[model samples]
Target chain A: MYWNEKHECIPREELEELQLQRLKETVERCYFNVPHYRKVMQELQLEPEDIQSLDDLKKLPFTTKQDLRDNYPYGMFAVPLSEVVRIHSSSGTTGKPTVVGYTRGDITTWSELMARSLVCGGAGRDDVIHNAYGYGLFTGGLGVHYGAERLGASVIPISGGNTKRQIMIMKDYGSTILTCTPSYALYIAEVINELGMKPEDLKLKVGIFGAEPWSENMRKEIEEKLGISAIDIYGLSEIIGPGVAVECQDKSGLHIWEDHFLPEIIDPETGETLPPGEEGELVITSLTKEALPVLRYRTRDIARLITEPCPCGRTAYKVTRIGGRTDDMLIIRGVNVFPSQIEHVLLETGYAEPHYQLIVDRKGTMDTLTVMVEVSENVFSDEVRKLEQLEYTIKNELETTLGISVGVKLVEPKTIARSEGKAKRVIDNRKA
Target chain B: MLKQLSVFLENKTGRLTAVTEILAEYNINIRALSLADTSDFGILRLIVNEPKKAYEILKKDGFTVRITDVIGVEMPDRPGGLNGVLQVMKSEGINIEYLYAFLGTNGRGAVVIFRVENMEKAMEILQEKGIQVLSPAEL
Candidate 1:
């Protein structure tokens, strides 16, 4: 049930010592090689030696996604191009794609971490992993591929799309493990239902889902529909991709690999680190990355860190599932709202489908939020008043939860565009 | 009591046409229909010859369709015809949620569909008042 037990379940003091050592080495590498780090360090009048303990980690400059974009192609890479054996870039749908490189040693470390992640999610060498995360450029597919290979498991690199064939192969090949985004997994379940097939027809036993923030309700839905234990795996392309942390079978929270990546929660507005168990922006520092050494990289993801020991017995501290991205946060008439909060409300209603889009428009000086949710069979009624009541109920629940009265629009089924990758849940027309 | 098919539709052009086209393709005749709409969405209530079949076809075509029991009563097909029925329901304090009317042939007179708060109470009152309530076969 455990992979790399020494590092995964290391004693608290021993793990801290290992983290400090690796942190020091990574800082020295960044200072000597990456000019961006050196310039920022000199501006703070700080040196690598100043990072004597993990507490000094706060002194290091925070790196943003813009910083990586400012560095462009390979500027943030600490090692030379020859040393970097592999390169990966984000989808860059927002702006410029942030590129990351990996040295051979970094690849090995990533593979080992992924191996640990797979085991943590209940996959073993005997499991056949059907990796549906896109392969090219995106780190999801290949990151999982290397890890499953490293775990000595059979991997079907059947990247995303062609879902019907993917399901066919899953059944034909007897794939025991599935790895993809949470939304994509639900789409697969829908397709299975459409094809008149049941989850029991497949041999899938475990699924590792990530790359987007999903609610616990989604986990239950996937578990029931797919007949598999859905495990949440957290990572970003900036860090080592897809294997930074993973939920053990305990399903409480994801265990961060403290030996390789140090995790912290910081107040997003103040940029000051928050105490454990407080919700804020998650900041991570890659302790052992060789090609690209990131120091206190601001993840922009909203989550809390739990220092309490998990029932799974992994000594590495756990991070609660990501709440939402700071960038995805919407300011409506001075009230902060996250789409996930709306999604949670909709899912909890049991009358609405998971497909919903948040549309924010500016009416003169006031910002208006209209939540368009697909009308499911359960909510539709022959009586207009009853249907209107369903809408009013959803609106009231949303207003109570979000503290801002919102317009609830009942859209027809399949009105929301379904994405095979990340689900696009928000459309902010107010942004100019 | 007759089964009426109700579909949730977005208030957009061609949505009504789309529903009708699907029903027409299945050779299902819409005897009487009423569209109730708001700025964002609409619910199309239909009294079709084959309510069960129409509901299945529309539902399989990805429409949010529902079937509900509604009363169909024969009217005089003249001025103030619906008023007389409403007056009868008013006397009994029976509230009508919604209603639509259509002409009937073969001397069956005009038929008015009634969706009321209490279907059985309205039916008993209408029957006792000597107003002819048409069944699905009569319609």
Candidate 2:
């Protein structure tokens, strides 16, 4: 719960020495072997000799998501295509997807990081892991799969969907560690209720949920329903997927692997590195990656850095709960709002359900905000007047919670769209 | 006495008007009504004239109908009139959740429709107190 300056906890001279050694080798590997790296360095008027240590990373050009898209399929691969054994692509919801390639050694390193993540969540050799993250191009599924195997635990690659079958396997296998997106875990809990099954019978001990940002309120809900300690794992396909950082049992924040990937928080507007505990965009430099080494990649995720040693004895740097993406922030009537803020309001309002949609429209020059919420069954009553009263109560509570007036529309339960992966929480009609 | 009527309606907007218009066409009066509406389904409640004949006519017109026994009680038009009824129900352990009122003839009294938690207990207590329960005809 408390944060200490971990990087300073260690001798600064020693940390910098270690970083310089890793930086030297990475630069040598890039200049001599990778054509893309060589071309980028030459174009930026830089050489391996000019980059003496990790402190000189600022001299290098920063990589963006658009850079990956520009390279397309194999343009970013540092080695020959035959040396690459695996490939993964982004969700491609916004634009053309960025593709990543990994060599056999790269996978081994990935497995090791994932193993560390599972161990951080207290998964040992005897544990049975139910891996429910979506498979194929997404790294969540296979990323957890190899990690569980490396940890010498029993791995069940459920690969998502079919809640009934997922439960059957979970109950039969006695899964101790659950791995999937947080939304899918909630969906599985819903199925368990529909089938009239008690959660105590599942024997799940821990859950590693990621792939999208979630609030602490969601963690408590999942824990209460499934009777498991849910932990957050943060990653992206471009940055070696779900093993980038993980929550220790303390559940304070996720521990980023500083040795493997260097993390820096930068102001999105000024592009200057901010000090620890300051909220800004996360920029990462892969110190140990081979086949496709990324230099100062801008992740666009907004989070504050915690440089403290965890009670669980992890000395790595931790990042606060991901506030949201810089791009996902919406401007409604000139008020900057993130979907997480709406989630916070809904969770605080005990009468409102999580199944709500934000409707945004432009009325001439100003933006209008309307929230459509599905009434929870606990508030349902036989009297029509009470239903209307409940609607008014929700409207007032939300207006007070968000500091902005919003129209509240109550709808029947189970009328909203459901996703087994990444729940769509916003509906902006202004652009449409 | 008691009055109960069932009004039939389709699952559409303004369908309730059609049912009310039909009752108006026959000069039959309505005291109260409750409606349960789903997107594509609806059930209408009514306390109207000739409850039995209305049910038969509505059923003949391809409308589902049902009937319930709702008592019309006459009470003094004073402040404690409704309080006196509630006090008795509370003593008898009966809860009234929802209710409606009907217009009474000049200076005589008013009729109230109550949906109580325990209907049988409420009727027994009122009958024992020598209170008259009006039938649909009085309305």
Candidate 3:
């Protein structure tokens, strides 16, 4: 059940050789075309020729989300705009977004990689892929769409929302594979029960879920409710969308496609690369990207790399399901939301520095973000309408900025606990 | 016009009790009270005998409290007595934000507290309409 068996099952030595060659070429492209990479390399007194072996990747300066943002909308693109056929953007910490471009060749490579991921997750040409990931500026929807088409499978491209219609299509169209976030899968399962339709009525067999961190208990729940094999896939827009890695039928760990991307684990605090099987921040280097070839991009996602060969016979190394993030970024319904973003909205409301706390919880199948702001003397009003208006204003501003709906509550003054050091800002009740 | 102490309270057990306990400790008698609430939190509006002392004590206890000026009118305790005051305000085009009733200290009729948008206009209209408007001294 492998797609591109040659690359998936490449020998360890041969894979290393391919990775090294691609890494050098990518570095050269970045240095010659992208000024940010060139400037950083020059500052470090390093050149493209300095990267002789895979270990030399450490010598290269690490790219960060801030670096990409500093470059802005098109500065990070190694290729010209005419060569970049498609563009996608992910949520950034501040107001600006992290934009990614894909050249025609890059699109083809992404399709092939995603094809490999879908096949690894037990999707085939005969399977009908019901892709529920979003389809706009976000990468998940079209990423899976192109790959499903490349796999020669029937893709529904339903995107997200309209759950009842999706379920109807899943049953009527006889969709065999479900692609969405793991929490969404559970939600669909709940909808199935509420409609009095059993899982057997649907033709679903395999589910590939990603875009948010989910627990193993959730996997078990989805499997039991939907009666399908739940596989965890990992990827980020900065690292070429959803096909960076995926779990095979083995269900142990996601096999990183070492042919196109080189993955590394590093100590998040010290920036030193950690040994294999050691848990730290996962840094990725795009080995074959034409539009944006990132050099050791700090993902801010904490994970470990497993070099042991999987039972599925893929020689590519596997990474455990992402454990946590090195920062306080919350993925609410697949949208990245930072506490600082909410604070910016609150502060921009023209009030004095207000005490605020973010309460993240899973309400049913959806992730809910509730912003608890203390009702300070400056903002307090005797009129209930005025107070309610303040709450509405905060909610509207937060929704406008974060691009997500949030529950805003005006609690009593000093109700939010104050810490002596680094004040606690978020209370996430979602299970790890 | 009468001073009313309004305190923000979260919808949790012991929160309302905590406010009451603090008020009792400070010897501030709640002459008239009304609690407006939503799902998340509540606003406890109170007409106390000593509003300034109550507001200070509640502020010291970390309660988001505000002192608001409201019109306290003495109305008949009989049915439709509230309609009389409402009819006058409706005719005069004065907006009442919220209103609540409590027994008057004389124990003869009910005293209705009205939180209006324009306190001066509401007081002038009520007095011209021959309504008994109780002031802070009377409360």
lDDT of candidate 3 over A220-331, digit per residue (tens): 9999999999999999999899999999998999999999989999999999999999999999999999998899999999899998878999999999999999988888
Docking class of 2: incorrect
Q: Alpha carbon lDDT of residue A14, candidate 3?
A: 98
For each candidate, report its DockQ versus the true two-chain complex: 0.58, 0.03, 0.69
List where candidate 2 sits over 4 angstroms from the true fold.
Answer: A1-16, A32-36, A93-95, A329-432, B1-139
lDDT of 3 at A71: 86
Candidate 1 structure quality by residue, lDDT tens digits, B98-136: 988888979767888889999988889899999989889
Task: List residue ranges in candidate 3 displaced over 4 A.
Answer: B75-84, B106-110, B129-132
What digit string (tens of lDDT, one per residue) describes model 1 on residues A1-432? Answer: 788887787999999999999999999999999999999999999999999999999999999988998999899999889898999986442335679999999999999999999999999999999999878887889999999999999999999789899999999999999998876788899899999999999999999998766678778989999999999999988998989999999989999999999999999999998999999999999999999889999988889998988888889999999876788766554344767778778777885547789998765334679999888898677777877888898899888876667999989988887788455789877544
Using TM-score as the measure, what is the rank order of every candidate, best first? 3, 1, 2
Work out the TM-score per prediction: 0.61, 0.58, 0.94
lDDT of 1 at A181: 82
Better of 2 and 3 by DockQ: 3
Q: What is the DockQ score of candidate 2, to 2 decimals? A: 0.03
Q: Pick the candidate with the highest TM-score.
A: 3
User: What is candidate 2's lDDT per residue for A258-374, written digit by digit as tens?
Assistant: 777888899988888888999999998887777788878898889999986677766778998787676665545323355666666667666544777788765532356887776
Query: What's the C-alpha lDDT at position B115 in model 2?
Result: 66
Best by DockQ: 3
